[model samples]
Target: MQSNLSSADAVERIVGFFEHLSAADLVRIGELYSADARFKDPFNEVRGIPAIQGIFRHMFTALEQPRFVVTGRVVQGDQCFLTWDFLFAFRSYHRGVTQTVRGASHLVLDADGRITLHRDYWDAAEELYEKLPVVGGLMRWLKRRANQ
Candidate 1:
C-alpha cells in the first residue's frame, strides 16, 4: 500500500493489476492486498497474500492466456465493486477455444489502501463446468431438466 493513498486510487490500482495480471506479477500481490487479506471465490477460500498468490499461480498453470477485462466499477468509501470478463483457454481440454467467465468482485480496502477482503461472484456451473467435456453434457442436461 502506498502512503496516504485514497480509496479511489486503491480501486484503480487493483483493477489495473487484475487486468494485466501474469505469473510474474504474483510477487507484487502484497502491493494490492494486506498481509492477512481474505480472498474467496466459488472453488476456494483463503487468507494472506501468499495464499492469494498461490491461487493465481494455479490459474496460470491450469489455463492458457488467462486475463481479465474489467467492464465496469463502482466505489463507495472503502468498498469497491468491479465487473469483469475472465478470458482463457483450457490447457488440456479445448485448447484453442477461448472461454469467458463473467463475474464481479467485491473489495474492501484498508486505511492504507490495501485490499483486506476480496470476494468474487460467478456461476461455476454455468461458466465453467458447462464448458467441460463429459461434465458439460451432464451440466447442460441438468440445466435443461431444472428449467423444465
Candidate 2:
C-alpha cells in the first residue's frame, strides 16, 4: 500500500474522522492511525487504537452531547494543523451547562498515510477550569491575588 498521502486527502480523512466519531467507527480510526499510534493531550497520553477508542467511548458516555466542529485547518506536507471548537453538555457535572472550548490539534502522518502522532494544544484553565463553579471561583481569586 502506498504510504504518501496528499495534504488534501489527509485533511479530508481527518474531517471525516471527527464527523463520524459518534458512530464509533473503529474502522475509520484504523485507517487513519498507525498500529502504534500515540495521542497526547493535557489530560491523556494514550497509545494504540484500543486505548484511544476507550477514551472516546468514555467521553461519549460522560457527556450529554459531545461534538467537534472544525473552525479552521492548515495542511503542509505530512502535517495537518486543525483548530476546532468542542461543544458538549456535561451530564456528570453542571447539567445543561453547555460549553464550547477552542483547541488545536497537530497531526503527523507517517509514510503509510496514517497518523503516527497526534498532539492537542489547549489551555485547561481557560477552556475548562474557569467554567467550573467552585474551581472557577478559586481560579478567579488566585488571579486577582497574583495581579495585586
Candidate lDDT (C-alpha), each:
0.94, 0.83
lDDT of 2 by residue, 1-148 (tens): 2446676787788887795577457545778788889999989999998887777787788887788899899988888899999899977678887898899999988876788889999999878888888999898888788899
Cα displacement (angstroms), candidate 2, residue 38, comes to 0.6
Lowest summed lDDT across 10 adjacent residues in model 2 is found at 19-28
| Residue 117 lDDT in candidate 2 | 89
Cα lDDT tens digits, model 1, 49-107, are 99999999999999999999999999998899999999999998978899999999999
List candidate 1 segments past 4 Å from native: 1-3
* TM-score for each predicted model, relative to the true structure: 0.96, 0.89
lDDT of 1 at 138: 100
Clashes of 2: 0
Clashing pairs in 1: none
The clash count for each model shown is 0, 0
Instruction: Identify the candidate with maximal TM-score.
Output: 1
Candidate number with greatest lDDT: 1
